[model samples]
Target: MDSASVPFAALDYIIFGVYLFIIIGLGLWVSREKEGRQKDSSDYFLASKSLPFWAIGSSLIASNISAEQFIGMSGSGFRVGLAIASYEWMAAVTLLVIAYFFLPIYLEKEIFTMPQFLEQRYDGRVRMLLAIFWLLVYVFVNLTSVLYMGGLSMNIIMGLPLWGSIAGLALFATAYSLYGGLKAVAWTDVVQVVVLVGGGLLTTWVALDAYGGSSTGPVGGLTQLMGDASNRFNMILFEGELMYQNDEGVTQDAYQLLPGLSVLFGGLWVANLFYWGCNQYIIQRALAAKNLQEAKRGLAFAAYLKLLLPLIVVVPGIVAFALDAPIQRGDEAYPWLLGQYVGTGFRGLAFAALVAAIVSSLASMMNSASTIFTMDLYRNYVEEEVSESKLVRIGRIVALACIVVATLVAPQLADLDQVFQYIQEYTGFVSPGVLAIFVMGLFWSKATPNAALVSAVLSIPLSAAFKFLTPEIAFLNRMLIVFFVSVALIVGISYVENRGETHPKAIDLDDVEHDSDPIFQVAAFGILGITAALYVIFW
Candidate 1:
């Protein structure tokens, strides 16, 4: 390794070791089975349906924020600036929508996985097909990308070999999670979130203080950064507004990434909704909640966390940019900040926090991917009457298998510049179809099994078509086109096939309650108000 690389000092390793001990112990402590009972699918996959609002809230953010946010999004902040935070800010509003609209519907169905919901709304064929698609994407796209990005950060700051770091992260996540399942993943996440947030703010504060350059403290750093990097503070990117260097060091229009007002009005919603509501690992925490109210409250808590995330994830990247950080790539920005700015005594604690983010997310995805595979595919098709204990065993096995596969695949992502944007673009290929099927099934009574099935099948190819055929169209815009087309196809086919009649399998939207107490109302409105104010200020 080059002398320029700042390897973790002895104090740093000691802090990280303590963090691992506490988290692993916590995960194992809660995962212990009740005195005489053997493990069941609910216990293994859904945390015994015993999670409270606080645990759910913490796990949702833990699962959602990871190398993707800390490393990849920070890299985005370095490349295109605060416009990348559109993902974070818009997600706060989307969480409320998910809480109000989506959570109740899923809870009422009493389902274990998203694929099972598909079976109830459509058919077994749809369920099986989508289950396979979800597994492939979770392992190949989501899980591997996180591992690659997390390793990239570790390599930069800790002076570890990239492949070894990827393997180490996989092993660390597997240690606590394989034995305990969702119960372990979720409860440990409560602790993980604390470490993750504390560590992030410390990093941001120090970086900002350094950026201030003796003018004042962190506040001065902020004022100076704002004044000097005025262009980096923009929330929207119109055509010809700005050009910035990507990971490859190629300058490009920021509009290609942010895509202007579409962030508020168009396909970004499709991505956020699918991620927050429809995606398995993310929503699995909500599924584990004790009741709908608890889940809603958990989502509310997460919404507030989302509002504050840019400070931790984005601001440091901007600080790095204003400082003209000498990094090899965009994803290296956060690690560079750590090596260059973060102090010795605290570096271990900060590094621990980053590890907390990575492993918590890794554990969550492995659990969810296994849930879909074992429940939807294995239990249903492989062995129809498998014992509950056996099902739990299968889940553990599948989770291990998925992690193993991801460990093998993650290193290949080294070529991508801005792994966060890469994940969004590629995941968009599948999101349009996933969103269309769920939205139509939930709200429209006439949506046919055939229509939903066709839309699900076409989501990716159509996205790829728009991507290759019309390269000039920004990906966010392409996703909008694919979504509209999917919706239109669903409508036309449903009307033609079902002859304007309600499908028998349609969710009774009226029966799915929208009732919320005053507390939920205040929280929801608070989220909306904050979101609006942010846009007004940032715009």
Candidate 2:
């Protein structure tokens, strides 16, 4: 499909314009002064730690479900079917665990960033190392990928040029986030999530409506879609089962990337735990919550939202396949469907949703990168006596710089076959070791700082070597191997270093009480149950 050939009508343009107006107004309004009071770093970076559960939850979803999920995951759905939803479904459970097990510690410590938590647990060296690493990833990897995908979608569906789309998105996100920071990002995210989910569902419904030929009714269309694409509905794919024939005319295995049951019990956990529990951008909303209960409740809400994501993001791709939508690449599935099925007025809303996903993620990443730079590095080391006002200024400067770098780098990602999978595969190398360090740091008293440091240093090279030497091993399995090896290294080094010596009191774990929110507990159980049912039904 030549995306340039599709034209949007006036109503679509009006709707899109109105959406932009309302969101910008809402963001500015929400972050505006109450009786002329000024916002400090606490307000700018952490929303003054006053966000409710709903705001926190909505922000989490908005930050997590970006153009990557819409374009990348949907593309995966087009090629690999329902199995790709494990990322979404499994994340629900991961969010629950983070809520119950992780939030208490973070909240008790009153920490602003993930690296701060590491510094509290280990040393400033670990804090400084991870902070710099996270800053680089947020700017180069996370921000760059989101910008590229968002630009690609806009170029395809809205007829905008790629560079123009990238610049527009960067400016749009920076417009609000630079001044209002997390307060603006979190509040605006509530609106973005509504639009994103609504537009996504609208696209899915319209695609399903057009699933069968003209002779078929809506129900018949659905039935025919399922009947024709039944092979694509499985949640657990076995090795060697042919998934899809690519443009190159080569058939790929159903479980080639996911590696079947390993998604359920293996390295997937490492990825999820690292992402949901440790990643700064994703967890920042929770960290900014008013209390541990609110954070837990917020996470529970995100968990429920995660359960519904596949319906909006994944189902449309499957529908596209069922209808044999004339798309050039699997990543074009969502945009192609928009060009075909969505009408004028709703087309703008759909476009707004895509823009919202892109902008929200961009804002979140910028804010987090700022947080790490300003709070972790600048305040602690560069200028310890900096005023809150000066720190906020520094944050804005750092955020803008990061955005500029990301925008410049985004276009380079155009050559990738699937930007989403590329992100996962590359990030997997470090996530395992990071997860191992956090797990041991939190639970194992014998885990020495030197051991954690060694594991962190060696984990990436080990993963790279494994990737090069044993290219046939699935990436997920490689993550599993790296995670265990990292754990072993941590354990062995800790034992040898601490041999015949009394354990240091400095390494004692934080004694934070669990958030005993009944609502959170019930919601967690309910989400887990639903996740289990989804796998059982779809498997």
Candidate 3:
């Protein structure tokens, strides 16, 4: 359990240092001033619809792979076996749909935020409702969970107390993001992806090596975990034992699967679709792309990374659990493993990577919250004719305010059990129904505004009610039911409302572009193939 017992060398530090320099440098470089006219809200929030495929792709990855995955997700994997990886796999199919189906409409219409699309399709009140709901969500759920959990990890690694670590994380993230805008966050995220991914791989490789060389027995350090009764993290499929006794004889199957086929078919898909497609914190990067072609490419690129994420996040935690390192949940797994395994200067690099991941995530959320507030609420309702500089100023202020609120809420993270699951439950209310509205709107011309409105209004309460009613049902299964029911209602309402009406224009498909390169195609297929392989191996 000591820091001295690993293969990590000074070269890791060199790799990490070079990586950090390049990332911060990218942010500073991209922070260049806009040419000619003063910047508008669009420029600040959406990158003026001019970001290339790679920047958008990096931002998407950077935003999505926050400290939650490293800390919360990997930690969950440590406790739950490989089943937790379903989130990543489901995302591949979701992105494939988005790239092929969703991007065309978003780009053609030149939408600023997802809520704006809602306004056009339904009413401004719905947009405002969503805007406020989403903004508060970022403050409480995304931003706060990430910052607090990230601080907890850093604290575990650096041996700092709760307050100091959390405060530092909030301050640093808010400072850079508040100073630079979406452009800053996107560029920083590109850098963060390299470090976070590299550090993740480094930890996994080291842990696997340690697992191979375990002093206790013939089993690899990683495989020994499967043998240990104390480390039984795999999902149990049996009925009648809704909760089983752990090694300590205290019942704790809260994270286990096998309630039914419902979770596999429905529960996970709802979470995945909501997360990858509808959530503002995740989808804002997609919205920032230059055009349909780049947006699709960017989404496909992110899908590719999602496929590889488990190797870094999930696998290492299993290895750590196998080693019987002291940690709680999956959130603390990475930091504990790194502190134990990584050597001196390499430790700094690892810590930096952790900081980068946390900061990038926080910065992404802050910028996005600012984006929603300025574009969806401020411009639409508060101040319609504000100058470009003033809008940017307001956006920055909003970002700062969100960070402050999130920072105050960060400490509350320690109170939740199965923190990731808790987050999914709350967000679930909105995401599935929202996804239905967008999907129905985009593909089905007959899908009327009334249908959209009805689905939006009813889906959340219905999902919540079903979840509440079905105490025997797994959350995932219940979600699947909600998703299908919402979809059905959407179709039914659209049919009823559009009985004899001609559909107005949704998005002009012909004007949209698909200028993809061969590399993108190769990457896309490669990612999908890898995801399929993972499912087969785990299944």
Candidate 4:
């Protein structure tokens, strides 16, 4: 499965190069310290808490959707049809919950990282353990998969060498992000999201237009696609209802990846809640908001964007499937579409959009990984008396180091089939326990630090037993089982430790407002209504 290159015109390179210049310049400019102001840890790591709702929302999406969505999920679309969109659709719902529920707790504490929240909730040991879990997953799985998937797309679409593309992405991400920190990442994400959505929509239009023989618009093209591969348009897939060929050339069903009802009522919630609420890189933008209202609005904005995303990311894959695209594997669906449909002049912008998606996420991941390393690990254990300047510098150094490690390991992903699903299944081992720990810690006052530690320790073994022993259960259902077991462990342990009394360390949110704003409520309901309508129409 070697990537076949496409013809990239001189104009395309010019557009891409110009885009790179502008983005780098914008990031540096925004991250610069003002006159007479000293750059401190707050300024470097949390963007000085100056982000607006739009910036927060846009950066959240920018950080969350990378090569994983553009290449991997789109590839999933080619194979599994619209069922893959359950991830994005469900995430919209998750963001609302995160905004109304999780943001209140995080903002109340002024938390800098997810581990920091854990420390405040339980103890330093729980914080340190989760910190290590996050650092390893961020570098090994999240960053490496994005690097390889982005590099794979670059190779197939623009004719770049794989290793060169991967290295180039790292350097490009580090250029502005390492120096400017979250400030640079958030502001530049404002521009990047515009490019990402515009170019992404353009790419989707090109693909849909081509799918209709250049005769139909997006609506007509969608109709043509639905008519062509009717089986690929379902939102829910029953066992044996829909079959797709894996990278190994074996027939399989989407049930394994997205089990039918569990997608709605069970395990998908565990995945989305952890990703949107607990992931450091994704939630750091919301943490930088000036107020909780802005955070809610930002998440609401991101939810709307999430609602529209499947049209951009997933539909093109289905279009490829309907058009009988000559791709070797599912992941190549996107790059093959870019190389074939996106024309000479616009290809540069499309290519820039792809690079923007990759680099922005890479930058966000590096910054958050550094945030956790410096704040949770270094400040706690390495040096308690460090200066603000040293902490900021340590953050920068840590950011660069994570990027370096990810680059070195990313090429190993060449052996993977669908890197997105691979990431989800492995990250599942951590998500169930994490969600359980936080859920009990936040809502149940009787949850003890020791119980959290037990839940955290048992997550991997429990998930592993289910994965290996059951073998027949779908991964989503397996996560559901692991989540319940982890919760049971926390509950049983907490009762024995605290005797049903609220733990001394449990959060008391009596003073904090427990409700969302009226406007935010309106927007939240709108998002829900739209999502429900989409499911009904596509069901």
Candidate lDDT (C-alpha), each = 0.91, 0.86, 0.72, 0.91
Candidate 4: minimum summed lDDT over ten consecutive residues — where?
Answer: 1-10
lDDT of 1: 0.91
**Cα miss at 39, model 3 (Å)?**
3.2
- The worst-scoring run of ten residues by lDDT in candidate 3 lies at 229-238
Report the C-alpha displacement of residue 462, candidate 1, in angstroms.
0.3
lDDT of 2 by residue, 1-539 (tens): 35433688998889988888888888888878778677798898889999999999999999999989999888888888888899999999999888877788778878889988888887888788888878888888899999999989988886788899899999999887788999999999999999999998888777777776567755676678778999888888788774586545577776658898889998789889999999999888988898888999999999999999998888888888877877767788888888878888888888899889999999999999999999999998989998888998999999999999999999999877667888898888778888888888877777777888888888789899989999888888899999999999988988899973434624344467785778888888899899999998888
Cα lDDT tens digits for candidate 3, 359-405: 89888888889988988999899989888898899998999899888
Against the true structure, candidate 3 reaches a TM-score of: 0.88
Candidates, ranked, lDDT = 1, 4, 2, 3
Candidates ranked by TM-score, best first? 1, 4, 2, 3
Off by over 4 Å in 1: none
By TM-score, how accurate is candidate 4?
0.98
Candidate 2: pairs in clash: none
